[model samples]
Each structure stands twice: as C-alpha cells, then as structure tokens.
Target: MDLYIFCRMVLQQKALILLVTVVVAALASAYAFLVRPEYQVSSVLRPAAINELDALNRSEIYQLPSGDALIKVGASLESYETRLGFFRANQKLFKNFERPGRTLEQSFEEFNYNSIKLVVPDAKNAGSLNAYIKLVMNYPEGVAGVAILNGFVQYAIESQRQQIAADMEVIVRNRLSELAGRLDSARSSYVTDKAAKIAKLTEEDNLKRAQLQDELKALRAQLKNQRADQIAQLNEAIGIAKSLGIQKPSTPSSLGGAGVQGSQPVMRTEVNNQQIPLYFMGVDALLAERAALLQRKSDDFTEARIAQIAKELQLLQANREVEVLNQRKNEDLFLSGVQPLRAEEVRLRNLNVDMSGLKLVTIDKKAIDPLGPVKPKKMLLIIIGIVFGLMLGLVAAFVRGTDQSRRENSSDTTLLPHSSIPAKKALLSNVEAL
Candidate 1:
C-alpha cells in the first residue's frame, strides 16, 4: 500500500529485486549515455542595403513602394544573396557531401540549410538598425552556433557586395558607352547634314550665276538686233536718194537767189531724178527719223537692261548672303545641340571611373572564430537526462510493485491454514478397537 511497505517487501526478496533494478537502471543509464547529443548553433544576419533603390530615390526616378516591408526586405535579401553567390556555394556544399546514406559533408549541409532563421525585429526599427542587430547576433563568437553560421554569412555578404559592385560597374560602363555612341552618331549626322546644306547652297549659287549670265546674253542680243534694223533703214534711204537722181545741191546760194526771184523757189532738181525732190527729201527725213528712233531705242534699252541687271544682281547677292547666313546659323545650332551631349558623356565616363575605383577599394568585414562549443548545450542535456532517468526509475518501481503483489497473492492461495482441515479417520478406528 505505502512506498515504505512495498520497498520493505521487495527488500525481503532483495537479491532478485536488486538484480532486476540494477540491470534495468544500468541499461537505461547506458542507453542515456550512448545517445548522441544534438547541438544547436545559430547565427543572425540582416539584409544588405539596397543600393539600387537608394540610387533611384536619390536620382528622383520614381516613387517608392508602399508599406510592404517584408516584400521589400525579401526582395533585397534575395538580390543581395544572389550577387553574393549564396546559391552557388550552397550547391557546392550539397555536392561535397554526396554519399550513400550519411557523411560529414551531408551533416554540414544539413546544418547550413536548416540553421538559418530570418526575423524582423519590430516595426519601429525597420532596415538599418534591424540589420545591425541581426549582424551582431550572427557574429561568429558572440552567440551559440553563431561561429559556424558566421562563415557562411560572411561569405554571403562579401559575395553580395562584390556582385553588386560588378553589376554596377557593368551597367555604368554600358550606359556610358551607349551615350558616347549616340553622341558620336549625332555629331556625325550633324556634320553630314551641314555638309549637305552647304553643298545645296553652293549649287543654288551656281544656278543663280548662270541665270544672270543668260539674262546678260539676251540683253546683248536685243541691242544687236536694234542696231541691225537701224543700219538697214539708213541703207534704204541712201538707195532711194540715189535712184531719185537728187544730186548734192551745188551753189545753193545761186539757186536760192533765182528761186527767190520767182513766186515759189525753183526746186533744185538733180540730173538723175527718179521722183520728185520733195519725195527724196521726205525719204531722207524718214531715214533720219528712223536713225534717231533706233539710237534712242538702243540707248533706252541699254539703260533699262543695265538697271534691271543691276537690280537682279543685287537681289541675287542679297539672297546669297542670306543663304550664307542661314548656313552659318545652322552650323551654330548643330554645334550647340551636340556639344552638351558630348560633355555629358565625358562627365558620365569620369563618374564611372571614380565609382569603379571606390568599388575596388570596398572590403567585407572579417569573421571571428568561436572560443567555446556553440551546440549541444551541456547543462540542458544534463537536465533532460536527469528528468528522463527519474521517469524510467518510477516506471520500473511501479512494474516491480505490481509483479510482487501478484506473486504474493499466488503463494497465499497455494498454501492453506491448518484450522480449516478435516479430522483424521485413523483416530476413529482406534476408539472402536478399545
């Protein structure tokens, strides 16, 4: 019933009970001692700053995302880890541990794969501070299991930084190159256009010169025709005078005096007169008139032609001047438009160079080694062992108590008391003999 009574009964049969208890307890302790200890190692890491986002913000490219902090952090971490060769290194770890069932490499791989934990501390401290705390906790020697975890974390961070720098450099170089190429193309096009414009202007100038020459030629031909007409008229007048036999009047004074004495001055007639003297005089007068008209027309035509030619030449010169000015203006515009682009390209190139230098100088923080074992906490293991041993001892005691009770009950049932027995038949027979 009581523990003392039960223990006493077992002690009375102490040899067997002791033997069973010793065997059971020994086996349990042995099993507990033989069991492998599991160690827990942990390291903390915070996501790296997103340089791209920073750049975008600084450049005022676009609006930032809403309060999706987790998504943003995850995306940033993933991008950062990828740059750092996290997956590649993980694959390598997996490959190295390849074996039939189990191996050290496999163990290590499991530790790496399973040991990582990501947590956001609080809403108040979001990016930088949270990352910092995570970094501190993950430091190699600072916390349990942190040392082993720190190596991978360091590798991941360094790898990420290197990758980011590389990507940035490549992007900057490509962009600068594209800008440079575009600037060069623009300059070339501008030059070609300017050349074409100048050539067109030259062609127009040549055409204008030819037109002026043609006008001059037409004016000269018109003058020559007028002179020819005047000559023909003069010759006709001379021929008519000769046919009329109108000789030159000799002794004009003697003919005039005789003619004056009469009512009408006697017409001084030539010996070879073909028509009346008045007709000859009229023909001569007509010739003179024709000559005068021709001379006047020639003079007027020449003056008008000269004035027109001069005005046209002035107009052509003015147009040519305007064309030259236009070409100059276009050239100036081309230079103005292209020069800034070239300068910008140069500036971008220089900035890229500086950025590359800075990237080259950047370095990752070094990892520290742990001074104590990070896993398989001894105190926790001991405490768990003690509790399990106590539980097993109690179970053994309960089972032993039950078995003893059954044995006692069986023995009592097998051995009967003398008070309950019947009187012997021999005693009755003896009484009859007496």
Candidate 2:
C-alpha cells in the first residue's frame, strides 16, 4: 500500500492501537518485575603457581604440576557426579527449585544442565595453558546464588584434593612395599652369598689341611729313613775301624806313611785330592753320631720342608675371612646394595605429607551477588510487545475499512434505477466501463 493510505488506515484505529500497545507493554513490565528472575554469578579460576604447588611437587613419592592441578580441578568441576553430589549435600540452598510436580533429581538435573556451566579454554587453541576457567551459575533471585557458586567451587577443589591425596597415598604405599621386597631379596641374596663363601672357605681349608698332613707325614717318614740309613753307615764304619785297629780319625797320607812299620821308609808319595769316606772319620765319631741318631724322638725338625708344612697347617686351622664372616652380628651393615634401597625407603617413609593443606587452584574472581538479573530484559520485551500490538491493530483496522467500503458500494448499487436493454449490448457496455 502507498504511505498516505497506510497512514490513514493506521490513524483511523489510533485509539485501538494505543490501547493494545499500552496493555501489552504493561503486561511485559509486570512480568519483568513480578516473575522470578535469574541472576548470573561466576567464579574465575586459574592454575596454581609454582610456589603454591611446591610442597606436592617436591615430594619424591608423588608430583603434581601446576597445569595438571588446574586440569584436575576443572575435571572435578565439570563432572556430573560431582555436581549431583554437591546438590544433594546442599538441598536447602536449592529449596526454591523443588515443588510438587518436580522431583529433587529433576531439579538437580535442570540445575546441572541449565543453571551451572563451566567455561574453559578452547582445545583448538594451543596457548590455553595459561587461560583461566570460568564457573558460572544462573540461579533464580533470592536463592543465594553467590553462596552456591562459591560453595560448589570449594567443594570441587576439596574433592579433587582428596582424590589427589588418595592417589598419592596409594603410590607411596606401593612403592614402599616394592622397596621392602627388594630389600628383603637383597638381604637374602647377601646371606646366601656369605654362607656359600664361608662353606667354600671351610671346604678349601679342610682340603688344604689334609694335603699338609699328607706332606708332613711323607717328610717325617723320609727323615726317619735317612736317620736309620745314617745309623747303619756309622755302624759299618765303626766295624771297619775296629778291624783295621784304627781307634781315631786318620788321614790317607798318615796311613801310607805308617804302613807295615818295618817297611821301607823310602819316599812314599801321598796324593789326597778326593773327599774322605765316612768310615775314615774314625770309630769314636761314628759311634757318637749313631748314638745321637738312635736317641732322636720327633723327626719334624730334621727336614726344613716339614717345619714349613707345620706352620702352614697352623695357619689353615684359623681362617681369618671365615672367622670374620661368622662373627658378624649384623649382616645388613655389610650389604652394600641394600644401603641405597634402605635410604630410599626411609625417604619415602618420611614423606608422609598432609595433602589437605595443599592448594590446587587460584581463584581469580570470587562469586558475588550480581547487581541485577540477567533474564527478563524489560526494555527489549516491552518494545517487542508494543510492536506486536501495533501490527495486530493495523491489520484489524485495514480489514474493517475494506468491509465498510464494500457495504457502501453494495447499497449504492441497490438504490440505482434498473433499465431493460439487449442482454449482449448491456454486457458489452458493462464490460467497456470495466
């Protein structure tokens, strides 16, 4: 339609349009003020600082980095079970949500699905490590939005903290058990080796003692035979000296010079270049050596080897290594490898930390009561209502004006005079006028 005609139609129903606009606008205003509105309360969390996680990271048994801590906190916050648990624990805070038709679980589901939201850094972005996570709660008015938000945040953090502590405890306990097993194995191995070595030493000493005994016995027998042979030779020499009537030791030269008394004392040549025989030593010296040989008791001193064997046998009787090993009171002290394992065990045992105090996340912005409700944009709603009312009123006015004009035309036709003419001619005339 042309602007003039459209304006005329609108002005014709100005009162109706005004009333409709006022009613719609007033309804929107009332709804905005009277109905319960939802407020948005949020808390911003970031990864903990290096210093804040120092206690957990410094531990040898377990380590939790800042990024990992943040991830864990976020996971706990986003977990459905965790949110449901929180809702169940603090039902009083959500009492307004519960009514006759809605069950507690349904309310919690609505609350979890709609009211609560977790905003995290986009995974598509690479540098999201330093990004903070936002936990938002859209709670109705007078529902303690601030407390619910803060309380859930604290609950999620505490839940994650307990999980970490449980994990750390399990890790430390398993490690300690492993170390204990290793230590026991090492000690057992050490004892086994020591016992084997002692047994080997004892066996070797016994074998060596047997060998020395055999050698000693052989040497003593040899010395006894030599003494007996010496005695026999001395006795033979004594008999020879008695037959020759030589009681004292005599050189060969003296024998030649005194030969046969009356024989010619002519120049007798005496050449003694060879060693003298045992019989030439004389009957008295032979008899004395034979008597000394017969009186001898132990022949151990006769041979130098026998004395050496005796001394070695005495040494073998007391092996110093075996003695030291057997005399040890604490074998653990002697285990070299077991020391490091024990030290590690001690270190782990001393790391019995209280993770309750450990901080996981840093709160960048704490949840607080919002200044105004986020829902029910009053101005926008009021404007929409007015526009809708105006459009409806305009359509109604246009239909009414069209119907009035049609009625007036119908009445004008009825009042006009009726004249009879050729049907074809009248039809043509009417057609031409059209």
Candidate 3:
C-alpha cells in the first residue's frame, strides 16, 4: 500500500529482492552501454525569388506566381523524399564497430528509420531548419549521410526549377497561339467587311456624280433655247411697229409735245381685233419679251442649276458623313474590341511560354547527403536507460516480496492446525529423540 510498508516487505525478503534488483540493474546497464549514440543534422531552404523573376521576364499576365512557386517547391520536396530512401539505407558507415557481435547494417537500420527526425519548421521558425541544414552539410565526417543529403537537395532544386521553366514556356506559348488564332479571325472579318463597305460607298458616290452632271447639262440646253426664243420675238415686234407707220420720237421735246397734244391721234395698230397703241406698243412688247426670257432663265436655268448643285452637295455631304462615321466605327472597334483582344492574346501566349520553360527546370541536386547520423541521441538514450532500470528494479522487488509473503503465509497456516497435536507428541518425541 504505502511506500514504507512496501520497502519493509522487500527488506524482509532481502536475499530474493537483492538478487532480482541486481539482475535487472545489470541487464539495463549492459543494454545502455551497448546502444549506439546518434546525432541529428538538418537543413532548411527558403523558397527563392527565382520564379517571380522568371515570370517577370516572360510575361506581365501572371495569374498566380506565388502560388505556382509554392506548388513547385512542395512537389520538389515530395520527389526528394521519395528518391532519398536509397541514400538513407547507406547510413551503416556511421555505426561503431566496437561491438563485434552486431553488424553495422542491423544497427544502422535501427538508427536510421525510427530514430531520425526530419522536420520542416514553420515560417516564423524557419531559421531552425536553415541552421540544421547547414550543420548537416558541414558535418566533419565525410560520410554517406552528408553526401546523400547534398545530392538530394541539389537534384531536387534543379529538377523543380527545370520543371517550372518548362511549364511556364508551355503556358505562354499556348496562350499566344490561341490569341493569334483569334486575332487572325478578327482581321479576316474586318478586311472582308471593309472591302464590302468601300465598294458600296464608291458606287453610290459615282451614281450621285453622274446624276448631277446630267441635270446640269439639261439646264444649260433649256437656258439656251429660252434665250433664242426671246431674241426672235423681240425682232418681230420691232418690224411690225415699223410696218404700221408708227413714227419714232427723235428727241425728248418731241415725245413730250406729242404726249401734250390733245388733237394728236393716238396712233394704234389693230391686229386680230386687238388694238396696239403705235407709240408705246413696241416698247411694251420688247419689255414683255425680255421679261419672258428672264422668267424662263430663272425657272429652267438658274433654279435647275441651284437645285442640282444642292442635290449633289447633299450627296457629297452624305458620303463624307458616312466615311467619317465608318472611320470612327473602325477605330472604335480596333481600340475597344480588336486591339485589347489581340494584346491579351499576346500576353497569354507569352505567359504560357514562360510556364512551359519553368516546367523544364530541374534541380541539380534534389537531396544532400547528411554529414552525420540523424538518430539515437546519446544523452537521451542514457537517460532512458536509467529510467528503465529504475522501473525494472521496482517491479523485481515487488515480485520477490510477493513470493516471499506467500511462502510465509502457507507455513503459518500449516503450523496453526498442527500446534495442538504436535504439543502432546512434542514431549514424548523430544524425550525419545534426545
């Protein structure tokens, strides 16, 4: 129950307790002495700016540069771990040969697998990994551990870099190709539509020009005909007046005297029952003929010319407005639709190429050889041994004391039943045996 009582019980069976304690302690001490000491060597590597630099060089359209780099790093680590198993197997060189009965292979296997602790520290405590890596690489012994670790790290980094390069190149190239295809299609459509529009506008412009020319020519002919008719009519009126015996006033005084004389007959020429005054009739007919010519010129010549000119001008204006509108539409489409799309296509193509390049990148040394064994910490082993020995000693003491108590209780029980019978026989037997 209590420690004191337990100790007293063990003391009562001191011989057996002492024997068991000695055996357990000796066995535990021997085990601790025979076990090999192990040292830990680790290394750390920070994700470099190599991926970012590569992306910048390749293209401006990076979707996830940082995420890509992290993914590459993780994949590289996985590959390294998988490939380094063979290197870990070679840790037998570090095994101590002081124990001839144990092979280095057997001892090394025990140390390598269960003992080694390869840790990747958190970002905040990443310095620890770096320190560990440096220690392993720089370990004094020219052992397989260091060689393997160096090889693994070098190969892994190189492989990862190559793969990233290849991937970047592929991605950029593919994107560019896709963009090029789209641009080609757009260019073809634009060329086709432009040709059609140009043809239509040219035809309309030619027709308007022809119509204006025809209308102008007809107006000129009409004007010439009206002028000829007016001239003929004027000449005839002058002749008729001459034939009717009408005297022309030679002087302003004569004309005024004629107008004042009441007895002067109003000289009239009658034609087709229409009386024409001999004095003013010729002048009136000439004025009417001139007005008719002027009216014909205004109607057929001047007005036709103005109307044709206005129509032609309107067509020209429409054509110019259409050209201007088409030009603006073309420019807007180029800037808003085509140019940006083309630029994007080019950008994506470049990025794809970059990603392809990254994919081809390879680590020169994926893993490094650990310079020292990464197992069986010596002080820890010794401390563990001591603890094991104490526990075994206590257990041995308890077992020995429990066996001793059983023997004592059996002896007391047998003696209690035999005590009365043995008392009567004790006197006779004591006398006879004496």
* Model 3 stretches with alpha carbons more than 4 Å out: 1-40, 47-59, 63-143, 174-193, 220-434
Among the numbered candidates, top TM-score falls to 2
Better by TM-score, candidate 2 or 1:
2
lDDT of 1 by residue, 1-434 (tens): 46676566555655555555566556555555555533334344333345524443342222233223224433444443442345346554434334578764555455345545444467677664444223322222223343334555545445534554565567667877887778677768877876787677767866986787788777777777867776676567667656754344333333345435546546555454354333244444656766676656344354476677767767666455446645564453545466666766666565532222221111123235445444445556555656655555555655676676666655654465565333323433332232
Better of 2 and 3 by TM-score: 2
Q: Tell me, what's the RMSD of every candidate?
A: 11.0, 4.0, 11.0
Residue-level lDDT tens digits of model 3 in 314-333? 76755774566466644435
Clashes of each: 8, 0, 84
- Candidate 1 lDDT for residue 63: 25
Give the best candidate by lDDT.
Answer: 2
Tell me the TM-score of each prediction against the true structure.
0.55, 0.87, 0.47
Error of 3 at 130 (Å): 12
Comparing 1 and 3 on lDDT, the stronger one: 3
lDDT of residue 129 for candidate 2: 59
